[model samples]
Target: MSAVLASVAGAALNIGTNPLAIAGLVPIVAAGLTFLRYLRFDPEDHPVSVQKLLPEYDFVIIGGGSAGAVVASRLSEIANWTVLLLEAGPDENEVTDVPSLLGYLQLSNMDWMYQTSPPTDSQYCLAMIGDRCNWPRGKVLGGSSVLNAMVYARGNKRDYDAWEAQGNPGWSYKDILPYFRKSEDNRNPYLARTDYHNSGGYLTVQEVPWRTPLAVAFLQAGKELGYDVRDCNGEKQTGFMITQTTMRRGHRCSTAKAFLRPVRHRENLHIALNSQATKIIIDRRTKRALGVKFVRSGRNKVVRAKREVILSAGAIGSPQLLMLSGIGPKEHLESLNIPVISDLKVGYNLQDHVGLGGFTFIIDDPITFTRNRYQSINVVMEYLLREKGPMTSQGVEGLAFVNTKYAPKDGLWPDVQFHFAASSINSDSDQIRKITGMRDSVYNTVYKPLGDAETWSLLPLLLRPKSTGRISLKSSNPFVYPDINPNYFTHKEDILTLIEGIRIGLNVSDTPSFKRFNSRPHKMPFPSCEQYEFDTDEYWECSIRHFTFTIYHPTSTCKMGPENDGDAVVNPRLKIYGLENLRVIDASIMPNIVSGNTNAPVIMIGEKGADLIKEDWLGQHFRKT
Candidate 1:
């Protein structure tokens, strides 16, 4: 029995256990790869033939994105236990390798390619940026991390403490900081090794060493605009500061590069690429999660779970899976002709942070990312030869925080964030983010130059939004995406706060330091904001309601909390309500969204969860029973 448990623990990458357990995994690796019958553990082996399906695993984790990969890698570290990671997308290749094409990956094969259902209100139609805005999710091996700009951040302490207060004990900032530290390999060679961060950790966290002179001037410009220059993720979230990225030297350090690549050697771990999880397998009469059903090469395959089935499928995918599994609102499932297993809040209380576009600016030097036809073999060769200049930059290298004149007054964290990217606003527009548009075409660059001036984007992000949204089912089909309603400006305060940010962006552009770079404020001639007599406070409010796009921060769906949380879908330990032997380890469990980028926090959750599971076993051993 001890040998069996020892083997199980060694297979998990993040599970902290004694050395003996690791040694026990040797045979499982041999048995799994050689012949499954060697150890009679056929359940852990992948099928060599297309006709055979491995019916069971100790753990089956859905979605191999940031959260899923971390959890699956850690859980499988236990020696003999079987683990299967199901991903809907393929691997990250050179397109993801090039930093210049980073923004273009959004709607590509790597992205889930979701969008908001057109609003019910007519004003929303008049308010769009161009056409439908693109929502990019990770479609490849590392999920979104494979394609993200690689901004590494830990949001405000208040955001976590708020979770504990709302019935999620041990989820406060103090409780989770150790996990964040545990996963970071702070590349700053000069930093201390004691408590701030760990050196041997799998995740890479570093600072962009080279910033254009314009970047520094932009920082000073914000300071001149009355915003404090402080660390965006430090003691205060307010003020302007450089963004800490997940890059090493000049390359993007996505999760696939960090955690997944190193651990693929572990024979116990297996990743199924192009495998899309369509639903969780639940015991209808028992009301317990049993396994998962997925599609591989257009064929439906059911994989059973012996111990647990975990959903790391992300905000949109997780809830969608639950609903399809007949574990959602009974009425909604029945309407689609699906038998109900258990009625729980699968898709409810969706929340997201959104902000308006910032003041536009053009560099006087004419040396932005958009220069030189956006594709110069000479430039690419320069980048490959020497890791210097714009090629090393991920465009937006600066960040700042500020208090909106009407934001929350009690905290040190600001309600606003300032993002400084190298490219102009129009360059990152709806047209460019589209995955499969006629990029490199003639009309886009030459014939359709709006206003005949080039402008890069600087965004003022509202950290704490009063706006609330919902995620509902589109149909009974598991393959179909959900209806995402961000309902921006539902709370009038969000619109007011954004308008105030626009005011600040205008102020910063007008500063003398910004004048040196000739970074003047420029707005697209959107008739909605100017025409139809839409200049008053009411018109501005109406425009905001229709014009906003998600900043890619969606959370609070399936939120963890105590009973009657009103918005919660899971317990404090991230266990989905009304279920056993199942857990959710992703942004979906975020009771309230963090104040900064969600990647760091998602990784932290995985770190903490490994300990929680191990600790549970330890506590059981120490019990009087």
Candidate 2:
């Protein structure tokens, strides 16, 4: 016999070894190889480090996050200028590079690990710890991008036109489209390269090279329901399509990798990891930002900014940092005993997509991700070699934006979004626990047995919530976490809208394409919502209240508006009012939440904000000449 056969036969012929025993070793060997590949792999070429201090830089960007990475990279293109990027977490390791491993990172050290304040009587997030939903924001260099589902969605054109109407000049759909196009590098040959998409840019936008059969069925179901199969990021978003991801060759192409890694060797740029900004150094007399005071290696250090300080620390961090720096509501600051500076509404307008998650469908076909070990081994090797397989799916395989009855007939934006996941949220045992932050008791009682079933799920997302919320200072100390109160479902209309969305999601399953799978509703009632009958409107309303949770797209805490608008914190150019040499350049500056995932829009904001800053300085230089 050959050497391979000889070894196998020798093992099988051992004193107590049966044929079944030898077969089991094959799977064990394959699993061991998968684990080794996951641990030894990393995609980043240049991971930055914290270097010695610089006395000054022309520009200082706080939070080496999604937008900050882009801003620092763009600003440093000028060889004469020096830029500094401060981040609170260390670099991403092998664990963060594999896209499917995203679930495991939330509880890791790279997460900020925030949670919403407990609801008063709504019973929202009842399944989570202490009745508060876990909010995991990435603390690493790429920030939330490293932790997000990696879907690339740009909101409808009318969303931007409304921004212009709200006193933000030059921000209409026509003006901002170029910036969006300028940032995308579309790699999917299947998608039509038109005015809506560009082929050469920094960020890679492509369809997942591999997808589950259920995801393909979802697209067919959309067509069966008489909806157009169109690109969501294209002219219309009313239909369903495979999601384009912020990934390159099956790995996450975070802003840190796309923007920062390629430019880290630039002589004038410096990155500081594990450095948290405690305060913005503002000269009280002149109302000008001078530098920043931060905590690094357990020692406080101050660094100067010669020109301007840009805040791209995201919605929660940006607004909280402003409040800590004495730049929020006067009464709240007084309550905390912090001296008041600019009394801007730093954290008043919190918004996020509230999703209702109980809608699931049991399918007769075993087409989901819950297969046996041999099939999983094939998927692992496929991804390892060709960068293709179910491993490329971003959990969310398809997205649909549609106007519910709540939206105006002529309104240009959709109020509800449906996210299609190929696998059942409850069917994945350890994954559901990590993704949802459910208590052990809740997980064991409600979701553990689901592992034995084959199912798919659709999450109805409230894109335009009538209710608004806020963030507040938990303590004046910068190290203390901020108190986030999304105040979900505060308005009764929100609950009603989501109920309509759930009805729509159910209606989609009645189509011929879905019927082929022998689909049936999996009606699992919540303990808190059991008072109402199954599938009734009352039951769904109760379910909406009980299971309502965020999709992690919070924005508008430092809202942009005209100069004299009372609620405005930043101006049309994103400059903070009553402050000189300072601006906020992240999603927090959005006047209102966009209609889709906020990552693509935030990257566009970084592109436009850099142009605005450069334009202003160039104007000053020309005037002097």
Candidate 3:
């Protein structure tokens, strides 16, 4: 039976695993003999009937992700309201289930794995300054939240207040604070004392266990630097602190794991994985959004929406959906022969937080994270046996907030967001790129290793950089990648901001308390950060332009603005301007990118969006939009 099971498993038609590497297809073969059903996000509820409204659903959601999942879960709870979700990738995988491998995202089939069409001359050249533009979006059930590094830092108050100043009413930090509290299930004793985080939320937001030497060293160094070590998400996002993460008892706590999974069994909810929506069906005469047309396993289907079509497909996917449905710039759509339904600038005003890195370090202790192979095996055994120990590390466990501005502090959030990883990974994820290459060509070559042997990185991601990017349609094909120009550092000020982050990293490493732990980076690459001698400030400036990369924080492609704004695509309520019964609820609605990794904020958007949806529905007394 064991041998039979193994053979069946290997026979499964995986998106990437070797077809001929059928070492043990018998497990899958055995499951086939037993006529097994696919594992579902909802496995316990009475079966949802798909017959009554086959052509139309109550709500047709595009992208089964952080926000879409919650939107479906909450909307369906009202009873007898049918909901449909469209995901471009498969739902079940051991890849998404394993927590530690979360950061290794550019792997086989977990990511949409995209890169920008290399920039042209008219748009200004990054090569003239030296930077390659690349982007990644999770093409799977959980969206980017499924593929992102699990750091859960939220942007401080200043960012939200700034958004309100930009005429986005009800979005100021004070105004939106309730929304933050509503989504977080903080378990930390220290964080619980704060009025900021609410106690009874669906998401389990907590700190990762510190198992490696690097974690302790980073904290010691930060304390020595005089930046009051405090929780970054507590009363203030202003102090140096060990960063919190989206982990539940040492495992990744994605939105699917929290709000969506448990509530999926509601009788009205329906999740359609491996489904790609091509267009939003808007009834021209009625002026109401009817539904969406999507493909599933090579079969096309049009699911009507009696309620609304919610787009929670992240920054790129949301705008792409909008533009493909003819809700974007009129001239651009016209050029692509897409008859325009609404000319609302659906894919402009793109914004992302890009990082310019600087690294120095190596292990000296006999206690390196990469010790003996037997030690690693033992750690994995303990983790599988009890779900504890070094195997639980979320890679980067510490962070330092810095006062990089030359002027007096604003009592606002710090200008810089620093990340500390326990074991050194010089490049993005060397391990995942290797696997992705085996399955697909275009997606595999996205990584370029930028690490020093035996060294960990203290990455300083620029959270509030003034630079912004734009998203445009490519030939009107849903399968084609969009022309993403994340004009990194388009504003010269962004250059200075990242330099400050590097300066803060250096200052923290030079502190006395850190000296006690020998936390200073190993001194082999003395006068470090690329040996080309970026010694002068001008040389440093060149180094900055040349070596920066996306921290995978892309947002604002479908930016929200006051209704009449020329460049805005969606309204503050997250509804696409000039389109009825269709709304976008995701990072794409961010008027500006936040100050940290976006996974937590994305989930926060879902939680808040669910409430907004309920509020709107209740205000209208459950009537159709």
Give one digit per residue, the lDDT tens place, for model 1 in 62-160: 888888888777766777877888888887764565455576577777888887766553223233333344567899877788777788778888889
What's the best-to-worst order under lDDT?
Answer: 2, 1, 3
**Per-residue CA lDDT of candidate 3, range 252-285, in tens?**
6666667667776666677777788888888776
Candidate 1: deviation at residue 382, Å?
3.4
Provide C-alpha RMSD values for all models, in order: 11.9, 4.7, 6.4
Which candidate number maximizes TM-score? Answer: 2
Model 2: how far is 577 from its true place, Å?
0.3
- RMSD of model 1 against the true structure: 11.9
lDDT of 1 at 566: 56
**Better model by TM-score, 1 or 2?**
2
Q: What TM-score, computed on C-alpha atoms, does each candidate reach?
A: 0.84, 0.92, 0.84
Is candidate 2 or 3 superior in lDDT?
Answer: 2
The lowest-lDDT stretch of 10 consecutive residues in candidate 2 is 15-24
Q: Can you write out model 2's per-residue Cα lDDT over 1-625, one digit (the tens) per residue? A: 1454345335434623343443344334333433444445644366568478689999989998789888898889778989999998887765565666577678678999888999874558877777788888989998988888898998888889989999999889888889888878889865637879887788888887777787778888888877777898887767888888998878778889888887878889999999999999999889999999998899999999999999999999999999999899999999999899999898998988888865778888878764332234445457665777765666788888867789768644678888888676654466567667677876565566566677888889998787888999989999899999888888888888888888888877777778898887777677676678877889998777666667799899999999878999999888999999999999998888888999999998988888788877766452210
The candidate scoring highest on lDDT is: 2
Error at 377, model 3, angstroms: 2.4
